[model samples]
Target: MKALVKTEPGPGHVELVDIPEPACRPDIGVKIEVKYTGICGTDLHVLHDTFKNYPPVTLGHEFSGVVVEVGSEVRRVKSGDRVAVNPSTAVVCGTCEYCLQGYYMFCPIRRGMGHGVNGAFTKYVAVREDQVYKLPDHVTLEEAALAEPLACAVQAIEELTDLHAGDVVLLSGPGPIGMLCLQLLAAKGCRVIVAGTSQDRLRLDMALRLGASLAVDVTAEDLQQIVLRETGGIGVDAAVECAGAGPSVLACLNAVKRLGRHIQVGIIGKEVTLPFDTILYKQLQVVGTLAHSQKTWVRVIKLLNQQKLPLTDTITHKLPLSRWQEAFDLCERKQGLKVFLSYDE
Candidate 1:
């Protein structure tokens, strides 16, 4: 089995090597044949050694595939069933305080699929049966691969913020997560303003096509002034920071109105000084969420099924596992939104 292994934390350390294929642990979990896997921003960070994790681990969390073999206790799925893998917390003790409250990610012993254990970047992945979800018959494997990041965006916007209809939403980024947030907020009937640098024009255009009220070039527009003027000298009702850049985070904070909600979805690699006074003086509600919950996945899939959001455009590049390097380069160059690696022959 060919799997991209991270030998060490440096440029070009990732290599495609023929490794032993994962075996089905029927007593413990199910083995899946990965059909398609999407490379996420986190995967890039992991490759760059910026986001530290277990060494020598497989490098993918967003993937979709077919059930090859099921564990003994896994009765919900069988061989040949299409599925999407949700690489979130696994083996949560239901009795724990966080687990009891349904905050699985907060569980002290929570183990994620890709970060803590082997992920879907290989020919086969053995995951807990509970973490697998059936992909809709109408959905393609490529679309199923998006469930992870889209679920994150859904959780960031729907669960973390208190947004009202007709309220303005200022999204400061045009990456996949940011574009997804733009679509989700527009579906909620909010006026969405997507702000990004000139380099992000392609993604911003896609956001506008999805439903954003306006797409402002960060270099050309006074984003804060535009938001304030559009909101009748007030400001946007909510601001979502989806770019993991210090300036984007600052812009989001500045665009949000007084007493407004701000959701920080981006993961800035390092600490940086921020304007705490604005938050305090305006009585702003600043919040942050790590990853998606199971409940959020359900809602995000539902939104996809309803045809209210079109995610296919975000998938601009598709390549085979052999071209993994090119895929990484494309993502790093910001040439596309989501790049899917086809693991199936």
Candidate 2:
């Protein structure tokens, strides 16, 4: 099977190569034929060697596929059923204190799929059946590929924060994740504000159409004051930092109201210098999240089924699996919102 292997960690180290096809074993896991895979910012960070990551890795986590073969115990999913996977993997003793409290992300046995194991960047991947969720018939395979990221976004917005209706939200960055944040906030009846540079005009426009009350170029003159004035001399009720840039982190801090909530969703390549004094003075709550929990993936599927969150609007590019490099390049160059590599018929 063909796969993009990251033999080295640095810019452009990801290579297209052929590898063994995934096999199903009764006591092991189910085999899935990957239909579409989405490249994420973490994949880019691994490529740039900005963070600690395993080498010789298959570098895709956001993906969806169809069941090709099932393990003996994998009655949850069967062959021919389309599905999406949540990439966060954790093993619990079930007797552990944390597992008893249902806080498994902190489990010592926690291991991410793409980081700790071979991920979904190949023609086929074998994963635990418990990690898979059946796709809605209305959701195309390409859109199903968004479930992983969507689960993360949903967890960040719904579970990780104490948001309320009529609160003002400043979403920094017009990337796919940021755009998804905008829509999710809007859905909750928040007055969503989107911020990005002038180059993100198209994305900003899309944000407004998706329910953002205001989308502004943060680089514009007097933008900070404009935000302050719009919020009636107070900053926004919450801010989501999705830009993953040092300056953007500071911007999110400066945009939040006193004691406001800030969800850090983006991956910063280096140590970010932040205004701790400002955060302290305002009594701000800053939180960071990794991948989503199993519960969150279920919520994402429900949202997709009810048409509450339309991920398709943010999907701007799709290429064949053979052109994985091209799809990855577009994401690295920031030329498109979301790019998918399709492998199935």
Candidate 3:
């Protein structure tokens, strides 16, 4: 099988190499013939050596596949089942406090797919039964590849805060995750203002098409003034920072209503200066969210099954696995959204 492997520790050591097909563990795992895999921001971090990753391993997490073989104990799925996988928190100590509480991502020894172990950027991948969710017939394999990221947005919206209808939301960043957040918030009846820089013109336009009340180019316009005008001189009821940029975080802090909430979904690799006084005076609640949970995945799947999310609009490009570099370049250059690497027919 051909797999995109990060062969060693460094800035650029990734390669497409032939490797042995993974065997399904009869007790708990299933072997999947990968269909499509999405190139994510974390994958870029891995390529740049910014995120923690296991070398000599495959480098994709957001993927969908068909079950070619399943272990005897894997009753949840069987051969020919089409599925989307939750790459993180797949393997964990079931007895740990976090795992016992259904917060397996917090388990002290959790081993995630892609980073901690071999992932789905290949012809075949062996995954634990618990990590796989069978896809509905209505959802295409390309859409299933989006479920993992959608689940992350679900976690941020459904788990991180108590949002109500008609609430104003300022979403920073018009990337794939941010666009998903906009759709979810809109479905919940919240009026969303999507913010991005001039470089994100296409994405900003897509956000408006996906129900964002307004799309602001922060570089070209005053975000604070727009927030004030949009909210009748007050501020947004809640703000979500999804750009992973320092300026975006600051804008969220400044534009949110006093005592409102700020949800951090984007992974900012380094430390940044924040306005401590603003947070203290405003009594704003700031929270950080990581990957999705089982509960989140359930909601995400439901949304996809119901055809409620506008996922197709966000998928701007799709290339074969052999053109992995081209896919990565499209994402890094911000020329496209939700780029997919097709592995099989």
Best by lDDT: 3
Candidate 3 residues 141-211, lDDT tens each? 88899998898898998888999899999999999999888888998999999999998988888899999
Better of 1 and 2 by lDDT: 1
TM-score of each: 0.95, 0.92, 0.97
Instruction: For candidate 2, give the lDDT.
Output: 0.80
Q: Rate the local accuracy (lDDT) of all candidates.
A: 0.82, 0.80, 0.89
Q: Candidate 2 — which pairs collide?
A: 10-47
Estimate the lDDT of model 3: 0.89
Give candidate 1 misplaced runs (Cα > 4 Å). 10-12, 90-95
| RMSD after Cα superposition, model 2 | 2.2
For every candidate in turn, the CA RMSD to the true structure comes to: 1.7, 2.2, 1.2
Give the 10-residue window scoring lowest on summed lDDT in candidate 2.
90-99
The TM-score ranking, best first, is 3, 1, 2
Q: Write down the worst ten-residue block by lDDT for model 3.
A: 336-345
For residues 1-345, write the lDDT of model 2, one tens digit per residue. 777777875655777777788667776487888888887877777777765567777878899889989987777788999998877662445556755665556667766666556778778988888778888798888778888788778889998998989998888888888877777888899998888887787788888888888888877745578679889989998889888888888888898889898889887767877878988999999999865665776688888788767778888888887787677778866778888876634
Best by TM-score: 3
